[model samples]
Target: MPVRYLIVDDEEPGRINLRLALADYPDWQLVAECDGNAAARAALARHDVDVIFLDVQMPGETGLVLARELACLCEPPLIVFVTAFSAHAVDAFEVHALDYLLKPLDDTRLAHAVERAAAMLRQRQREAYGAALRDYAVAGAAPYPERIGVRSVGRIEQVVVDEILWMEAAGNYVELHLPARTVLHRITLNRLEALLDPARFLRVHRGAIVRRDQIASLATGGEGSHRLALRCGGVVPVSGSYLAALKAAMAF
Candidate 1:
């Protein structure tokens, strides 16, 4: 059987370009194309796809968020993140993603990613599975915080993870929030999430992640959407798709 595949990116042109690039790969069937994380999530729940060409940055839920969820499945498809951002490469490999493809969708690169996906599907090593679990545990460590190195003026500074109130993506850099300070780092929010404790730090929006203790309350607005009000009085909008997870986290 042809390797069933799903292409997920918010950009229509990017998706179309990827399809065109994969035209020669007859062994890889283009099973679905999803514009956003919600659509991709729905498709994954219903399909038995072999691989996914995912874009890391999207409007609502990011590819990383979807990837983490997929990792919980019995047989998660091989993930190849198709992203314009290169800063996330380290984090991608940490989560055991099959490969990473830079955007603008190079034909050669796409073909290589597809080939890697094929190899992963065939072998499906238990070591890779164990590595993925180890990555998740290391990434999700909480309560006792670790020191994250950050570059300050002239030199690097070690910041305690627990002091973080929230993080916001600002173009190529991520803004780290704390009780009395806010600093900018060269890393993207996606990369930062992979290093933070998921139980204590929840991504409430596409561009933001908040520490659970820092969240003052969650307010529901029109159309069933929610907004996270932080102890600092900063508010971040939460999409409907992630509302369930947030509500569950806040419960008890």
Candidate 2:
């Protein structure tokens, strides 16, 4: 019943210090260490980690952004914020972080946070955390992600959600269609759909998801088949099952 955890910090020294401190806890095991939010997400995709010691600040995307994405996940890991700035405390707690620890870590505070995390996990209180995350989003404390990270050529690329006109299934991956180009994102259409804001995106077919604003017109063909023309001059099919939902979303 060991607690598997990942440490996410931009600074190597900070990661090292936290690793050394966590070594004192016999029941805790270090699953992996990541330099930033993107690496952490990649690690999470590969491993079933129980907790994440997340640093609030990073170069490209902040830890809070990652936390917001994680909350949308089916089963998110427990988050413990570790940072130098105390100013992010309120935001951290709003995301239902297990604990927030300031940098230049204090032994007593670290131990307490570790204990609290272990207790919560043992009690199987993750559902409560998930509920709080939903409530946080509903309360407008956190919004659906504006950008999504996709691993590409040994680096993570940030895809602006608003720029995507539609999404098509590409084997195990999803192709994000933009106005001028298409970006391949390594995620399933269903999973990616779950992460997006439902109010703005709609599933027109089993293999297609289109932004609401991009829909120009819906065309019907022989045998009940239908297709939608996008404002960007792109077309996507519409399955009969989703037609009603699409019509409702389009207010037609």
Candidate 3:
């Protein structure tokens, strides 16, 4: 499939330079061009674009503003900022742009950005197709997930569920305690716990969840309080509100 492109720059010369640079690539198709952010958003709604070659310093609505809005979208296209100023490179990437290109259009950098965008787009397409195939094969049946996809600063990592010994609630994030290391995942503890298998995992406290097999011993605390020691030598407290469920699970 051809890669669709949307160009957004205030100057006509900048747009023309990008078009000339991309014309050498057979797989690239220019879907639309807009002078500003509003026009760009309209063009985006009208076309399925793979990459946006945007100018950072535009009059009125800036490219950074549009990029930030796109970043919050469920499926944002790859963004490559085209600008004369090198000072805005950090700001452009902070908005999750795939690449930043200095103006007067270096042919080498333009080619590299388009290639990177194409590769990323192809990967996302393949993953989406694979998911659709799995859903069709299941025929609406639900299967437990073995791994969770974690989106971090600049990349996504797949974590094995079985390797997780316990999980704790952090402010606006969940910490997954694994054997070798702990990962601060940007997901709520309650949401992550729901994805886990109920039989194999248990919510021992309001703020903590533990793998069933990882529980090594249940220790006593003051005033009839209880705490759980894990096979990994880590200990977690069993709140009074959850003590009954813990007792039931232990057959006490």
Candidate 4:
């Protein structure tokens, strides 16, 4: 398969430059060209991109924020930061970007980054195949996963389902709140909800989902406002649309 990629840059010239530079590598294919983070997010959901030639600065969301959120993907696309400002080079590497290329793009540097992305992408493919094999070995017993893998930089962390207290929808990502910390997973709230066992997790609001056992109290206020007080000392809004279902789920 060709190495699919997306070019995300606010400037048209930058996007064109990267697109033309990629012509040298016939193995890499351009899936889409996005002008900002929002468009990139939408494109990502629609395609199986293997690499991203991303700009560091943009109008709203910076490339760093997008990269951090992408870390949750089982196989994150290789990131090659393309920007004029060399100041962000450190920040780019912190997010485990494959390489950083300064603008007025050099042919030699761009070629090197492309090679690096190709190498990393192949490694991830091998790892994913192995993971699928492992999952298949025990998939018959439980249709829903007991633990989820969260990828970051060079490592993959296993998060137990029972340890998740709640989840919040953040753009194209889902924030998994655990006892010790919160993890950003590169998936929509609805998609994540579908993967979890319904008996253990309940959607309390359009943007929130909570573990059934963590509901400490249902606080009601004026104007039909409702809130869920959790045992972990956190509160989540309870939308009226889901109120009746919440009550029934709690057996009250």
What is the C-alpha local distance difference test score of each model? 0.72, 0.77, 0.72, 0.75
Considering summed lDDT, which 10 consecutive residues are worst modelled in model 2? 88-97
User: Over the stretch 188-210, how does candidate 4's per-residue lDDT look in tens digits?
Assistant: 68767766789899999999999
Q: Which stretches of candidate 4 lie over 4 Å from their true place?
A: 1-133, 153-155
Counting clashing residue pairs in each candidate, in order, gives 0, 0, 0, 0
- The collision pairs in model 4 are none
Clashes (candidate 2): 0
Question: Candidate 2 has which clashing residue pairs, if any?
Answer: none
lDDT of candidate model 3 versus the reference: 0.72
lDDT of 1: 0.72
Q: Which lDDT tens digits does candidate 3 get at residues 98-183?
A: 36788677888777676656765766743432232232223213445565545444344556778989989987677889999998
Give per-model TM-scores: 0.51, 0.53, 0.50, 0.51
Residue range 21-129, candidate 2, lDDT tens digits: 9999999999999999889989998998988999988889988788778778655787888877654343335222235788789999898778767876877766665
lDDT score of residue 25 within candidate 4? 84
- Largest lDDT belongs to which candidate? 2
